[model samples]
Target: MTPSSALKAESPSALETISRNPRIRIRRSGPPAEDAKCVVYWMQRAERAVDNPALDVAIDVANELDLPIVVFFSAISNFPSANLRHYVFLNQGLRDIEADLAERGISFIVRRPPKNSLEALLTELRAAMVIGDENPCREPERWRSVLAHRLKIPYWTVDADVLVPSGLFPKHYFALHIFRPKLYAHFPTYLVKPENPKPVRQWQRPPNFESFDVKEDLTEGWKHLDRTVQPVDYLTGGTHAALKRLKDFVANDLAHYQDRRNHPEKAGTSHLSPYLHFGHIGPLTIALAVDQALKQKVITKEAYDAFIGEVIGWRELAVNFVKYVPAYDSIDCAEPWAQKTLREHARDKRDPVYTLEQLEKAETYDELWNASQMQMVKFGWMHNYMRMYWAKKILEWSQSPAIAFENAVYLNDRYELDGRDPNGYAGIAWAIAGVHDRPWFDRPIFGTIRYMSAASTGKKFNSKLYIRNVMENEPPPLLT
Candidate 1:
């Protein structure tokens, strides 16, 4: 068959592979515009060129039509819970993606508008189809829905952030034990790498549109964003940096991860949360690399599986939690028993009750708690083990459970790069209320909810060392 005839015959079913994949979902069902020019990828969550199914789908659809692809990322100035730190980190990663995409002959345009600029861009391009990554977060979800409705072309969203897409499972799973097996069942089918489509036509120039140069605009972008929270120099965001961290973790830390994870003084954890949160790296990329280490015998299978369980298991479970539970960040989503028990102890508080100001400044009696707070404030990151103790104390010291929950979420989302995420929301819920935990022994203020004390934490790790290290070290200068 002639090349033109072959493409015509296969073009009808070219999108079938994407349509049938469990990872991809069609948000709006309409045939591609017959006389359209290019396929558009409205990039949001997944920032990397590598291992992105959404991008792959866009490439495939564009190739079938023998057309070029245009990728647009709307860097809205007022993304919820985002500040200077988050923007700096996210834009740095975006710079990497733009350079990478340029090498592959795809246009990567970014806009920093305060309003919804998607419809304008889509209309300008006269795109045949629109593609985007699936994000369960409230803000992204709303924006995507609005944009999809505005577009007159076919719009599809692909799940590339999580290893097993969040949509595959039931809206909410009670615990890791219940969700882990079900997640594993589909591993054989969905864990493989996504198809990478070769474009038949290459995009020559920047799409005939005016947009912000990510690197240049970032400086002025910060001017319009909240500058209260400054970017930390400790973690530079990008796929290259994220990959380096993952490589080092697999080589040095993965073997001891299961054993030393809880020790605050040790570097046993992979500090890739910021990168993962910003979509600089995908979970599947991290998981596949860990799996390769296991095959090479560089790391034990036990450690490999343990880390994978976390990368896919608990992380995706948290995504599931927020997907099903709209009020996941607040006390409204707490288990019935937990809500009842917490209310019973509402009037039982007796000791010092600190205000949100006091807490944000890390001015507390407990040295360990203060250090943890300081770490989060100064470094834009904190020890995983310290997070549990850090949050419980907020509940123990606040005037009310509701106030405590609000303060915890505010401080967490305000400072951390990984803030406003499912993991953060679910983690806070677990700490303040027994979201996935069973009722513990009744206490004065805690009642049946799980209680974590500084005393108990001290018994597990050298609290003095954690405090001393955090206090003595100087954090890297804020990125400008």
Candidate 2:
């Protein structure tokens, strides 16, 4: 069937699930194989089986072409700044994907490649066409570029990362106010629930198929990986856990979300960041559930609107910003005015300068700052509002703005389960250099970049209560 006719064949729910312009066809190295055994999905970013456009597209195309579907995921053994904690979280989610695919009679293969060797695996499989998920990070971007250049088969990138797809805004948006109307206009179309595409033929292992051990020892066996940072005992990873967290939040805390979201002590916010970061659940799934709650009167319209704005509005805006803005993790990526003003204040003296070690060790003078650091370092997450305060303080205390940006990114990416993501990068940029925000009243160290003081945190919420609650059980620091 032609591409247009394929869309015409799908029901409204299925159309809502996949995208109209999901496929970004890379340069065809050669014509597709006439009798290829299977359609290959190189799962990179969107790691889930459900509510994932790339997987759905692959399945749909496989059904159309009368081929079986095989999902391949390469586990990069040396991911940047990834420690035991990061792997543990990722492995937890991957286990779920493996089991789910098994139940569906789909073949899912995972391998730990040496370096940029995904093409070798594809060659071995003789894939007719390869499909992949979209991610804006430097590493994945490079991988996709290389694969597109080298692969003899056609490569397609399907963006399952954002509600309003990245193609909508070909340029960087200055602010959320500018994108609000654009987002709302597409909400009804994109927010509908998507059904999984069923294959006409299930995959079976070929006689000469190469198979490596899919078993993982998240706790101990991965000696090749860095194991310094251990996983948090509290949070479990996977779609099941993410959905449960969403259910509890909407049932209890969502109605008061607007008023209580900023208060770290309340613990009233939805703790779904890790799940979203891992692609355990897509934004549409959460948004649809929230919409259903609104209709059922489980949550008020005001609460639903506020929650949706954060998930669809602010969250998607961050994704959009990172997608369009090159050098997104660095201070150079800030708006011209922000860059100029920040440079103007570069020489401003920082009192009681702290090294990255001091900051990382949570040995700072301020108890609140130390506690917030402890929360992130120990728990692998931090409340969003406190994160703003945390990054601004790094700028205030570090030797230079450049160094401050580096330190903030390092610690955030190292600890947060949601680290190394666009939200993390954009959030740090907003905190340290004011990327999306407008110029504020000029200050000594902050310049025109927005300033967030620890004292202001006290005025907003009970800082002492938060510190006490989060840091109550931490033991004293070990001597060097």
Which candidate has the highest TM-score of all? 1
Report lDDT (CA) for all predictions: 0.82, 0.79
lDDT of 2: 0.79
Question: Could you give candidate 1's per-residue lDDT for residues 253-294 as a string of tens digits?
Answer: 888778878888767888888888888899988988887888
Q: Judge candidate 1 against the unseen true structure and give its global Cα lDDT, from 0 to 1.
A: 0.82
TM value for model 2: 0.91
Position 225, candidate 1: lDDT = 72
Lowest-scoring 10 consecutive residues by lDDT in candidate 1?
1-10
Enumerate residue pairs that collide in model 1: none
TM-score per prediction, in order, is 0.94, 0.91
